[model samples]
Structure formats: structure tokens, C-alpha cells
Target: MTDQTIIWLVLGAISGSFINGLTGTGTALFALGFYLVALPPLQAVAIVALMSVLAGLQGLWVVRAAIRSNLPRLARFLLPALIGVPLGVGLLASIDAGTLRLAIATLLIVHGVYFGFRTTLPRFRARTPIIDGVIGFIGGLFGGAASVSGAIPSLWLSLRPWPKAKVRAVLQPFNVVVLAMTVGLLFFQGAYNERAIHALLITIPIGFVSAQAGIFVFRRIGDTTFRRLLIGLSLLMGIGIALQELF
Candidate 1:
């Protein structure tokens, strides 16, 4: 990789790692913004998937105790997600790269605005297994396309009545399994070759340090402030990329 490319990927990797460490999710949202600037859309997607598997493993370790208790809840989310992922991957493989990037950039802009502005979201009183499974399927589709499976679940869980710890516990394992599958799918699609391996090797150690630092800051900072800043940056970058591609 060129020095400039390496620098951009490292920045994105560290930032995404930190976000994942803090929220147990949101890594793809932040990382894709930077990766899209430095790499091709599908390459960025592949890199985020690979790193997310590592990050998700770390997250699950931190919440290992809570995973057992959330099994039923997680199963409800996981099954439909698995069913949907291959379908989404099929779509991704068939779509034009420019169209895929446009789709990804649009999601980033919309989701960033939504996450940044919503101080509190209402809990759904009518949540059922069917609804949960559907959300998982949608999340899986997003994951297959962009390594962003956590977005739907994170938003849905945030509004649930579950405690914050339970939410994090569920999110960690949920994202882990989905992201692992995404990596495998992308690999079969030939996204994981020498370049992908090289990128991962260069970024892993730095990502580890950044993730730890994010966990520390998560405990110290005001969540609202940190979220607004990060998501705001994502929103701006998404816009820039979309405009560049269009023009």
C-alpha cells in the first residue's frame, strides 16, 4: 500500500476500533467513512468486516458472563439474520460497485443524522419474535453489503426496556457472528487476497490500542457529546463522497 493509503486506513481502523470498544458497535459506520475515502467501496467493506470480527471477539470476551442469559433473545435475532445474509451477499455480488457505494453513502448520511439527533428513542411495547427476526434479517442484509449489521440491532435495542448492560451483551455476540459470516462471504467473493491480509496486519496492533483507549474514554466522557461529534463527521464525509461520485 502507498503511505497515504496506509495512513488513511490506520486512521479509520483506530477510530472504528475505539467506537466499537465504547458502544460495542458502530465500528462500520465510522470506519467506512474513512475507508471509502482511501479505498474502493468493496475493499473498504471487506476491511471493515475483517476488523469487526476481531473487535467483536474482544467485545464478547468483555461480556462473556452476560451472553448465557441472553441466549433466547440472541437466538431470535440470529436465526433470521443467518437466513438473510446469503441473500444479501448475492445482491452485493451482483450489484455494480458504484451503485453499492451510493447505497452505502446514503445509509451513512441518514443513519448519522438519526443517531446524532436522537437523544432518546421510545421503547416498543409490542416487540415480538417475528419483529425481532425481521429486524435481524434487515440488519443481515446491511451487514452483507457493508459490514454494518449492528446498525439496525443497535437502534432497536437502544429503544428496548432492557438494561444497558444487557443491550451491550446482546450486541457484541450478535455482531460477532454476523461479521464473521460477512468476512467468509466476502472472502469467497475474492475480496480477501494479499491486499486484504496486508491491510489487516498493518492495522491490527494499532486498532487494539485504540479500542482500549476508547473503552477508557467511554467511562469518562459524556456519551452524547462523543456520539454527536463522531456521527457528525461521518455525515459530512458521506456527503463528500456521494458528491464526488456524482460529479
Candidate 2:
């Protein structure tokens, strides 16, 4: 790889690590930014998915308390996530990546904007297997297409009457499966050539180091505060991405 490309990969890994740690979206900011700066679409998706798995496994270490405390809830989310992940990956293969990116950007932008206001959407309250399957299916599609699929499921799980620990645990299994499904698809697509694989090699290790820093930092802040920060950042990034088509 050229020096410039290597730089992008390193930067991508760092930026991706920060986003997942801070926002829990796999690669909304970094992966989207790389593509905005003109990386090939297929490559962009692959890098985000690969680094996501690495960073996620890293974060998994820190979140074990959250994971272990909510065994039943984790079970509730896992089966559906696995079922949805493959369907989501299949959609990734069929749709136009650019179009999917634009659509996801638009969805995030709209949600961010609405969140900025006092307006709130109703939360999902269903506990049936069908509901989980449906949410996971749609979430998987969006996750594979745009790396931001967990938001809806997160919200849906939140509406349940469970303790917050169990509610948050709902995301772990889903994200793990999403990352795995994406990696599998990218492998079949031959997205792991020398350069992309090299990028993975360099960034994933650093990503783990950074994740520890993220945990310490997150401890100093409250979720309410972090939620506002994410919304604001996403608003600006959304406008920037949407306008990118103009340039």
C-alpha cells in the first residue's frame, strides 16, 4: 500500500475505535468518513466490519460486568440477532452500497434532529420471539448496509420493563453477530486483499489499547451526557455527509 493509504487505514482504525466505544454504532463516523474522502465502497464496508470485530472484542472485556449481570436478557436478544445477521448480510450483497449509505445517513440525520428537539418517539414493548426476530431482521439489514443497526434494537429493548442492565445487554449479542456476519460476507467478496488485511493487522491491536482508555473516560461521564454529545456530533456529520454528494 502507498503511504497515503496506510495513513488512512491507521486513522480509520483509531477513529473507528473511538466511535464504537463512544457511540456503539460499529462504524458510523469513521467508516462513513473514509468513504466520504473517496475510499472504494466495498473496501470501506470491509474495513469497518473487520475493525468493528476487533474493537468490539476489546470492548467486550470492559463490558463483561454489563454482560454477565444480564444473562436472561442476553439470551432474549441472541437468537433473533443470529437469524437477522445472515439476512442483513444478504441484503448487503444485493443493494447498491452508495444508495444504502445515503439512506442510512438520512435516517441517522433525521433521528438526530428529532432527538435534538423535545420530541420523543414511543418505545417498543413487545417481548415475543416474533418481535425480536422482526427487529433483528431489519436492524441486521441496516447494520450490514451502514454499520449502525443496533440503535433501533437498543431502543426497542429499552421499552421493556426489565432493569437497565438487562436492557443494555440486549445489544451485546446483536452486535457480535452483526460483526461476524459482516466479516463472513466480506470474506466471500474477497475484501481481504493484502492492503485491507494489513490495515486490520495494524489497527486492531491499537484499537484494544484505545478501548481501555474509552472505558475509563466513559466512567467519568454519564449516559445522558454522552447521549447528547453523540446526537450533536451526528447532526454535523450527517449534514456534512449529505452535502458530500454535491461536491
Candidate 3:
């Protein structure tokens, strides 16, 4: 890879690791954003899925406990999500997806804004796994396309009284499974190849190392600070997506 691509991929990897570790949606947005600019649209889609599968797989180690605590709820969410993912993937294959991506990005920004602005969102203290499955399916679908999966669920989990450690742990593995499914579909469409593979190999490690730092840092930072950062990024990412399509 060229130095520039490597740098971008590395940044994307770290973003994935941290977000997946701390929140849940994995790094689809950052990876998609990076790949969108770096590769052909079709290839970018595959590449994003590829990284998600890998990173998600890697993240399982972090969030297995979260899954153990809420298996039934997760099953509900996953069943619907699994159904929705293929539908979403089909949408990706058939549509002129720049618009889809634009839409997804728009939602991500909105999701992030809501996450930031809400001072007292309900705690997921004990949520239905089906809720998560549905969210995950939509998130996987949109996440596969727009890389914003982590935003919604993360926002949800962060608000819940779930221990920060458990939240992080459960999210890591959850993303990995969904990402695996998403990428498999993408690959069937001829999106998988040496380039995407090489990219994943090189960058996932970057994400892993950076995620360790992100985990530590996340533990240290207060919720107030995290919300502020999330809001700012949401605004910026939204505007950037708007400009990418409009301009």
C-alpha cells in the first residue's frame, strides 16, 4: 500500500477498535469513509465489510460477557437483524448507493446528535435482546453500507446502566458476528480480493493496538467529555457526507 492509504487505513483501524471496544457498532463508518475515498465504490463496499468481519471477529474477545448476560435479548435482535441484513445488502447491490451512503451518513450524524444532546436517555438496564437484534440488523445493513452501526447501539448502551466493561465486551463480539455475515455477502458479489485482504491484515492490528489505548482512555474520560466529542464529530461527519454527495 502507498503511505497515504496505509495511514488512512491505520487511522480507520484504530477508530474501529476503539469504537467497537467502547461502544458496539464496530468501525464500519470510519472504514467505509476511508475506503470510499480510497477505492472504487463497489470495492470500497467489499473492503468495508471485510474489515468489519475481521475487526468484529477480533472484538468478540472483548464483549463475550455482555453476550452471556443477555443471550435471549440478543437472539431476538439477531434474528430480525440477520433477515434485514440481506435485504439491506440487496439494496446495496441494486441501488445507486451513493445516495444510500449519503442517507446513512445523514442518519449517523443525527444518531450521534441525539446521543450527544440527550442528557437522560433511558438506561438499557435490562433491554430485550430482540431490540438489539433489530437494531443490529438495520445497523449491519446500514453499517455495511455507511459504517454507522456503532452509533445507534453505542448510543443506546452508553446510556444504559450496564457496566462500561460489560457493554464494551458484549459489543465487540456482537459486531464481529454481524460483520462476518455482511462481508460474506459482499464477497459473493466479487468484492473480496487480495487488495481487501491485504488491507485488512495490515490495518486490523493497528486497530487492535490503538483500541487498547482507546479502552484505557475511555475509562479515564467522563461521560460529559465523551458526549461533547461525539456531538462534534457527528456534525463534522454529517457535513462531510453532505459535501461529498453534493459537490
Candidate 4:
């Protein structure tokens, strides 16, 4: 790799890992742009997926107790998502991926702007298993079709009144499992060639350190602050996705 490529890779790793550590989602939103500057689309995506899974493992540990306590609730979202992935992959050949991404980007922008301006964020305290499953399935579909599984779920989860750990428990594992499947799919497609492996080796260590830094911040933040962070992330992610597509 050129010096510039290595620089981009390092930046991507730091940004992606830190966000994943802090929020349990959004590695791609922050990292993919940097990766694209350094590598081709497939390789950039593969690296980000692997980075997300690896960084997310640490996040999973951060919320392990909450995850254990909410197994049933997690299942309500996860099972349908599992079912949705292959279906989405099947549709990928038929759908316009860029258009789909643009549409999702618009939804995220609108949702973020509306919720972000409110002084008291809307809280859905009641359990809604059906809605959760539907969102999860759609998120998986987006993951398979466009590699943005975390977008919808993160938007939904940020509205809940759960503690930070409890929210992270759901979002972190969900992204890890879904993105792990994505990595396997990419592996079979030969996206991880020697060049990709070399790039990964260069970036993973930096990503680990950056992730730790984010986790330190995560540990110190209040629950309400974390929720606001997610809202802000949603707006930023939306703008990022839109800019990525338009340019």
C-alpha cells in the first residue's frame, strides 16, 4: 500500500472502532468513507465488517450482564433478523442498492432531525415485541442489501428509556452477529485476499486502542447523555450516508 493508503486505513480503523466502542453501532458510518479513499469498495466493506465484529466483541462484554438479563427481548429482535438476511441477499441482485441506501438515508435524516430538536425525547416504555421483530428484520434486510444493518435499529433503540448498558446489550450483539454473517459471506466471495489481510493487520491494533479510549468515555457518560449522543449520531450518519451516495 502507498503511504496515503496506509494513512487512510489507520484513520478509518480509529474512527470506526472508537464509535463502535462508544455506541454499539455506527462503525461503518464513520469508517467506510476513509476506507473508500484507501481501497476498493468490496475490500473497504470487508475490512469494516471485520473491524465492526472485532470491536463489537469488547462492547458485548461491556453489556454482558444486561444482555444475559434480556435474553428473551433480544430473541424477539434477533430471530426475525436471522430469517431476513438470506431473503435480502436474494433480492440484492434485483434491487438498486444505491437507491435503497438513499431512501434509508432520507428516513434517518428525517427521524434524527425531528427527535433531536425535542427537549424531552419521546420514550416508548411499553414492550412491543412485534414492532421490534419487524425493525430487526428490516435492519437485516438492509444489512444484506446495502451493508447498513445498524441504521434502523440504532434509531429505534435510542428512543427507548433503557439504561445505557441495556441498550448497548441489544444493539451491540445484534450488529456483531449480523456483521459476522456478512464477513463470512465476503470470505466466500474472496474479498479477503492477501492485500486485504495486510491492511487488516496494519489497522486492527490501532483500532483496539481507539476502541478502549471510546469505552473509557462510555463508562463515564450518563444514560441521558448517551441517548443524546445516539440522536446526534443518527443525524450525522444520515448526512454521511447521503453525502457518500451523492458524491
On TM-score, the candidate that comes out on top is 4
Across residues 55-161, which tens digit of lDDT does each residue of candidate 1 receive? 77776776677788888988888888887777776787676645755776686678667866777644556758888888888778766754457766765665565
For model 1, state the Cα shift of residue 120 in Å: 5.4
Clashing pairs in 1: none
lDDT of each: 0.72, 0.62, 0.61, 0.91
Q: Model 1, residue 216: displacement in angstroms?
A: 2.9
Model 3, CA-based lDDT:
0.61
Q: Which candidate order results from sorting by lDDT in descending order? A: 4, 1, 2, 3
How many clashing residue pairs appear in each of the predictions shown? 0, 0, 17, 0
Query: Which pairs clash inside model 4?
Result: none
Model 1, stretches more than 4 Å misplaced? 37-40, 93-121, 125-127, 219-247
lDDT (10s digit) by residue, model 4, range 68-115: 999988887788888877778889999998899999999889989999
Task: Give every collision pair in model 2.
Answer: none
Sorted on TM-score, highest at the top, how do the candidates line up? Answer: 4, 1, 2, 3
* Winner on TM-score (1 vs 3): 1
Residue 32 of candidate 3: its Cα lDDT? 61
Q: Taking the tens digit of each residue's C-alpha lDDT, what string does model 2 give over 191-227?
A: 8787666766776776766655655665566555555
